[model samples]
Target: MAVKIKLMRLGKIREPFYRIVVADARTRRNGKAIETIGKYNPMQEPSLVEVDSERAQYWLGVGAQPTEPVQRLLELTGDWQRFKGLPAPEDALKQAEPKPDKKALFEAALAAASSEPVVEATTPKKKGGKKADKAEKSDKAEKPEAAEKAEGGEA
Candidate 1:
């Protein structure tokens, strides 16, 4: 029987979490599994991946083929690298603790948004020679004269 390492879907609609498991290749997705080895939570910032390294390596050694997403998760959790006899990644898993407080981050973002005036970005005008400059000057000259006439009419 061909064994496959794959993700078993869980969680509510529109919010997905997954369990990494080893099962018969012909088994339906989200079906019964031989063993659950880990979990993946993509809803978290940067995503959360946890795996049982020993179990993962043992299954890989015994010829369980990993599905693409499972393989990617293993790569992330450093299990895939260890399975391939590679060195542990430097500071990757270690640095995974919440780097900053989430509430503080949210408040700072909100404050920044509220404190600033929204300005639309204008595309730069293409540079042309004298004709362009003359046209620009004519436009500039028209605006203030129009403003002056309005002011005079008000007076």
Candidate 2:
């Protein structure tokens, strides 16, 4: 069975307490959990999030996926980072700050476009539509005069 690390609801109506657990993906929201790894209490001021980093990292490393809100909780504990082996938050900020030059980006895009063969559009254009209509009317007017002359000559 596909496994997911998600929440199990435990508290009374409108007063919610969640157990962050590793459970089968097919199970109901508060069903039998394979293992409880953490707890989340949003009712408290500043919120309370307690997660076992080692257990969380282990479950994530072994392919147990966390649900959206659970993923955010794992991020709070840095369990997600530890599982992925990313350098700590401070180092990540330093690496992320340097923006690429716009000129370099534009030149790279231009080079790629130049490498590809250009394609001409094959759809017919409507630029000459009015002129074509006028030409058709002129041709029809000339045809009737030519037909009259031919009939007069036959008479």
Candidate 3:
């Protein structure tokens, strides 16, 4: 009964999640497992891998062979290195920092906006766009016509 450690596919199509488990080598990819060790989610930004080191070491000691992909996952978790008596890779153990909450970010932006001085425009803006321009032109035209009528009366 050749024992093996491998991944069991889960989650929806095109969005894969996996369970790291120990099972018979001849069984199906997602068949019943003797023991579930951890989970893996590759869809995340940094990818998520969790494994029980104690269980992994014990299984490896008892002659459980890990599949290729499962071996990479175990390496990420440092289980494979520890099982093989090798030094764990430093970068593999580092986790990404948690993102700050949106509320705090919003409040910080509001604070920044409030601290800045507001400058008023020197010239007043016209309320009516083309209508105001047309009214000014009509007033000038009327003023010219009235002057011509006065000059003609004087003559």
Candidate 4:
């Protein structure tokens, strides 16, 4: 059987992840593999590609032909260059920055909302303003006296 180095599909639909494998060339794309050597995740911020250099070199030495995409991945990890006795490739990808946690973000917003000072509501002054207010206050103050006088006189 002709040995081949290739990628096997994994992960959820529309979100593909792959495993580098050594298998028979005649096997289906995702069929059984003789050995798994690495992983690839293209969905991440800085697409992730990983491979075992020693195993990859061994496979290459033993006449395992890598598929085109797998060759590119091996190149990204510098395994392909190393296998060919070439110098290390320059940085092809940057590391992704760590993202803040959702819970931490929510807590920060809650703390900000609570730290702000509370505002009290006040009634707006009417058209008559001070005169209307004074009249209303005087009316309130006289009602009890007027009711008391009426009650006393009736008794």
Model-by-model lDDT, in order?
0.90, 0.85, 0.92, 0.92
Q: Which ranges in model 4 have alpha carbons more than 4 Å from their true place? A: 99-155
Off by over 4 Å in 1: 93-155
lDDT of 1 by residue, 88-132 (tens): 776474335647888999999999999999976697766888999
Model 3, span 51-132: residue lDDT tens: 8889999999999999999999888888888888899988675576899999999999999999989988989987799999
lDDT of 2: 0.85
Clashing pairs in 3: none
What does candidate 2's lDDT look like per residue over 15-134, in tens digits? Answer: 899999999999999899999998988776557788887888888888998999998777777777777887545422112245789999999999999999998789866768889999
Give the per-residue Cα lDDT of candidate 2 at 142. Answer: 100
- Backbone clash pairs for candidate 2 read none
In angstroms, the error of model 2 at 8 is 0.7
Model 4 weakest 10-residue run by lDDT? 118-127
The positional error of residue 111 in candidate 2, measured at the CA in angstroms, is 81
How high is each candidate's TM-score?
A: 0.59, 0.56, 0.66, 0.64
The worst-scoring run of ten residues by lDDT in candidate 3 lies at 88-97
For model 4, how does the per-residue alpha-carbon lDDT over 44-116 read when each residue is reduced to its tens digit?
8788888888999999999999999999988888888888889988977567888899999999999998999
Clashes per prediction? 0, 0, 0, 0
Query: What TM-score would candidate 3 get against the native?
Result: 0.66
Judge candidate 4 at residue 143 and give its lDDT. 100
